[model samples]
Target chain A: MSAPLFNLRGVAAIFSAEMARTRRTLLQSVVTPVLTTALYFVVFGSAIGSHMREVGGVAYGAFIVPGLIMLSLLTQSIANASIGIYFPKFTGTVYEILTAPLSAIEIVVGYVGAAAAKSIAIGLIILATAAFFTPLQIDYPAMMALFLVLTAVAFSLFGFIIGIWAKTFEQLNFVPALVITPLTFLGGAFYSIDMLPPFWRTVSLFNPVVYLVSGFRWSFHGAGDVSLTASLGFMTLVIALCLGLLVWIFRTGYRLKP
Target chain B: MPIISIAGVAKSYGSFTALHDIDLDIERGEIFALLGPNGAGKTTLISIVCGAVSMTRGAVRVDGADILRDYRATRRKIGLVPQEIALDIFSTVWNTVSFSRSLFGKPKDNAHIERLLRDLALWEKRDNKIIELSGGMKRRVMIAKALAHEPDILFLDEPTAGVDVELRRDMWGLVRRLRENGVTIILTTHYIEEAEEMADRVGFMKGGRLVLVEEKTALMRKLGKRRLVLTLAEPLAALPAELDGWHVELESGGSQISYAMSDGAEKGAAQIIQRLGEAGVHIKDMAMTESSLEQIFVDLVGAAAGSQP
Candidate 1:
């Protein structure tokens, strides 16, 4: 008999299941983040806005909007994907999928694709919520959307790697809590790298999140801490790295086959 | 051609071996049972064939396709009901089963899924999430999902472990029905009776090796050992000199004497009784029991344990 064909039905099955799960956890997925972003707007907008008035040539509230949205987007994308794959590993349901006729890339597309879709939806929703608090402008709407999508898919892919690498629930939380969150905060999310001391500006270069923020903020204010080309190059590099690592995972059967 | 063939297949975890140079061939449309105790590598062997566990060395082919090179082909031919309760606990039964079918590239067919649910007696509970169902119900869902793709070969890994009698029988009936449709079935179970009743051929694995594979009836006939028990009319304190010459032991307050009768020991019982009568021992009753697969399984496992360590 011929090998089973690869079809959209397979991806559709997985994607639909994951989307339904999102709907089921609507409160946790949408409401919690929106509420948290609103709180960030209130506290940071009022407390710091009165003194500085503006940062990065934009209102304090608007400057932080992209930062907070990016923050939630990254975390949510990771959480949605890592938990998505990890729970199956925990429950052992993944064997069914692994033993199926679908290729490794197909499975990745199904999972990472679903995660990216959710993160993008939430990203857009957060953008809508931010409109109420501060005036917004988009110098490059297409580039902004591109960055949002690329970031979501890249981070979701990163999350997929973490899911396969994590042996326990504690390992799942380690990178997100101790690594991603801290990096997002320090990578010029609240303040432009130019505003920092010369020494601090050099240190921020080492943080990859700075590149993402710089490109994304440039889409809004027409300029950022770094050139748009460098930001795009960095994003492309990360996406390639994530895909390369995932392929290695499938080839080695690391933490998957036992 | 054999549906599944394994030659010199071996698996090792670091230094500890899970399967050791195992070789076997399973013909199409046969219910082949791999019987072994826990840690005997029954699950490991099946996992290797299904491509869930990579082999350290050797090759496995399903339907004439190499498992590693043409993985999708082999995997598409096989349906595995893994030992774990591997289901999304919050997904409804219909969605889980249908999703499983699509994963294997099978088209959606509500009528087929409906029949499957009806066969498993899960049609009424189709809307219930997996977590809300009982353990046995969840097991049925696992079976449903495996058959959803309608593969030519099915591997049931410990299908009835910890299951109630009703569900066990229900599952066996389903297996028989599946086989009737020309689907080859390979099942691994520690429950010897399950193998005895269901398998056309039985393989005994121990210490990561395939120790024995034989037709069920032939194995029963060749290795069958029976026991004969004689109830004494009166309790005896000790055996007489004539009885001492025979391989018999007294039990049940010395009122019963038992003897292990190997294959072809046709006249052993009669001769022993004749000698007992000559010794003035009155016979009250006699009972005999043919050895079952359960007894043979214990002996085989015990022998393997003894030989290895």
Candidate 2:
């Protein structure tokens, strides 16, 4: 029999393995993000919001919801994808993947697909938790979903690259912890770039996370520090760059093959 | 057609050459054992064929499909059980095997998987996590995972390394059964006896080059030596002139005589005995022994080493 053009079963196998890992580590995968979101609501929405009142004509408590979800989405996307691939490399089980009748694209689709799904789930869960704290509105639900998915997929791809690039566990976590988290914080996850001084605001424009948060926030409150088109454009650019890098990685075999 | 054909394949890492121009072809449904010492490029060669390592030069084909160009087609036909027990500790025995089958783009065959697990003696522990299984069970799980996709050829890299004697025997039995079912087998091993006991043909590698490849029995017959050892009735001070024509040695302070014969020299043993009898030498006990594969292996490697500058 001729082989199928696509190894859909291979992709599904990787996807389910990653998802099962999530289910197995429910506390780390789901609960921690939800609890962290709750803590943010308790601290920022209750204590801090009671004093700040509103930001950009939206309640301060409601304003940070999109940013918070973006934060979790970005981090979880990176974490899921990076850990998913890195663990196999670490355990030497990647031989099975490398030897299987799988193209690099199929491998990426399986890993990134699961990672994006996970972060999306966490993003929605955080959104629901945000709802319990303050009333929320999704002005463009479809656009919101678009931004959520695109951001998750883009970052998950980036994480897959990190997973391949990393030689050690510390290196595996370095990009997400040292780089992505700080970028998320400074990218107006809690405060708007409009609130930043002029000079710093221009520098904030250089931070890619700003575009993601702004686009997601606009989907929720119909307002953002940047234009919606710019946000979407930046999202597309990030996705394209990540995909390009992934292609090169697989083509070159990078750290994945010896 | 041969199930696997490797031609002019070489792999190098910067300044270090791991494998040097190697050409080999493995026949269908036969057990081909690759015997070599460490750093002899056995694993590197296997890795190149299995697509785990890129070859710096040349091509490999599985059933006429080029390995690099038709990777999916070639890879689908081969299963590799690497030396290391690489597995997801968190995954259960069943999921591990099933996942492997799916990874090869095979449709879910629960029945096939069940039978496989049963065959490997892992059925009862199918639900148990890999970490929960013993080392031997984990090794069997690796075998199960490799076979899950039902590949036409299997490459076992040191399959019995670190395994207990009984488990090794079980694995040997399993491999024989696999061959009986028409799965071509290529195994690289440090254990010469494993090759001697199971291989139909054997290839000897030394320092990244395949030095010798021959049918196991033929190799033994060609390089094998025979020794006729006799316990002399009395301790002799020296060999008699009549026995000097034969390659004989006096051991145990001249209390025993050992007659050595190379291939096609078995006729010499009877002459040596007659010579000893004519010389009034009496034998209290006599025994004959043939050289083992291990001895032939050491001799080949030693010769190769000696031939090196």
Clashes of 1: 0
Error of 1 at B252 (Å): 8.0
Task: Write down the lDDT of every candidate, Cα atoms only.
Answer: 0.90, 0.93
Best by TM-score: 2
Best by DockQ: 2
**Local lDDT at B307 for model 2:** 86
Q: Report the lDDT tens digits of candidate 1 across residue range B1-309.
A: 899999999999999998999999999999999998789899999998987888999999998899999988888889999998888998999999999998888888999999999999999999999999999999999999999988899999999999999999999999999999999999999888899999999999998989999999899887777789999999999987887668899999999999888766768888889989999999999999788998888888788888885
lDDT of 2 by residue, A1-258 (tens): 677889999999999999999999999999999999999989888898989899989999999999999999999999999999999999999999999989999999999999999999999999998999999989999999999999999999989989999999999989988999999999998899998889999999999899899999999989998999999999889889989998888887888888
**CAPRI band of model 1?**
medium
**Candidate 2, which CAPRI tier?**
high
- Cα shift from native, residue B71, model 1 (Å): 1.3
DockQ of each: 0.65, 0.89
Where model 1 places Cα greater than 4 Å from the true spot, the runs are A4-7, B227-287
- Provide the clashing-pair count of each candidate structure: 0, 0
